[model samples]
Target: MGFEKAVMVRNSTACAMEWSIELEKALRPKNPGRRIEAIYQIGLRLEQWSGEPEGTMVVYDMFGLVPGEDRLFANTIFLRLADAFQLGNKRDVKSRALALVLFGCWADFAKDSAQIRYLVLSSLVSSNVLEVRASLFATGCFSELADDFSSVVLEMVVNIVTSSETESVVRLAAVRAFAKMGCTFSNANRAFKVS
Candidate 1:
């Protein structure tokens, strides 16, 4: 579904509520993953229109349709991908990985959902994936915990920039990410500085 349709459905109220149940059933791993894939695509489309917070919330809420039972692993992978894109990223691989991590963490800082926060944070703290870590670092949720997490992410960005074998583009992206969040690199003798 496109953003237009998602908004229309949300406004429709009847269709939105009905699809909420169907979307949950379709998310079951026992069923074909393609249905979940379709819903994910629809969510992706809606995210493009995220300027409308209510519409974005309505669209994001649809993700709850995926049953939260008997599909931990599959759902984990699925939600990760969803969150990466939803959280926003430039590349496909990075976006997908970030999605998984963010989706896993949504409930942590979300409205009255403690279990989700715990589940996601526990997994995030243990994840070995750099993109996942980066995604969480960049999320709005991370900002609440930023005082606790920024130094770590700053270190990651520094590491990515300093490593000899890292790709130039990746280093550039790290710089961009840091600048986006008001971080700066200070070098005493450098002629040009990025802030």
Candidate 2:
């Protein structure tokens, strides 16, 4: 079963220049949704290479594919970038930081996995001042998290909600994160009741 699944995944990721070029063209236009879609497609393929021999090389290629002057692609690009870091390679710290920022945004949208959530939170909490100044979360980057890292991210949501200094949009993102974490108002209230 595992072999079959792996083969199916590999076939799905078979190299194709046409789609890649098309994605590049859309990225050049800097269309937010289109760029995100391209990133999603590319990420699917990259994810397939998790333990493959050339996985690291493929990830590096993705990083280099980052569209110049395209902010829309920046978000999606960085999400993949973080994966690159996790897989190994500390050669480019700047790229790592950029990717880490995006990873946090992705995790905010991701589901209930303590490890994934902690990975993102660790990145966020340990980020240097310059990364924070980059405003990684300010943009329309993370619409929703997937169900892989939800619980560990809730504390971040709480911080964003309670902090007076946090930006309104950032707070809004926290609200959205809470909703995605499956913590409705009643669940949240129950915690306070116990506290």
Candidate 3:
């Protein structure tokens, strides 16, 4: 029955609001494992809905359901990911990272790009190299919003790339992030000038 409902929600936006409400209830911090599982399920469903208008509406509705100070539930999701990392559970960590990426994409699509970009930038500058790498991957969500973030993001990425104390993998990730953001900014700027 739950599987059927999940499928229904993905296929149509009519029931998304009620379903999202239930899912949000399950996402409360009372049970960490359950919350993680919920986030994973949301990521899977979001993937299924990718590029569809209905899916976009569903994401927008879900974000609306959450309080604004909650950062569209990003804080809750990241807290769970942080806990998984602290436990050194590689599988859980990867799953949570994927979930974060999905959420970031959804946020960008929902026109909340600035908030998600800032969140990713803050994570990248964290002392933990693992968090930095995860944030670098998440930054891809804001590729289209490069014009809004390019300068600050470029400065931060360059700093990471030049810092000798940074891990090799993180530095590489930062380089890639820089390239992606730089290209996006240049393209956007050219398009604006052309228009």
Which digits, one per residue and each the tens of the lDDT, describe model 2 over residues 1-195? Answer: 986665444322234333445545544533445544555565555454333453334443543433222223333344334444454333434434444444544443332334334445554443343333222341223324442233334555566567788667555655555554555565466435533
Question: How does each model score on TM-score?
Answer: 0.41, 0.38, 0.61
Question: Mind sharing the TM-score for model 1?
Answer: 0.41
TM-score ranking, best first: 3, 1, 2
Candidate 3 segments whose C-alpha is farther than 4 A from its true place: 1-12, 51-99, 110-113, 184-195
Give the per-residue lDDT of model 3 (tens digit) for 98-191.
5446545564543254444555666776666666787776665464455566555666667787888989999898777766664665654553
| Count of backbone collisions in candidate 3 | 0
Off by over 4 Å in 2: 1-12, 16-80, 83-116, 126-149, 184-195
Pick by lDDT: 1 or 2, better one: 2
Candidate that would win on lDDT: 3
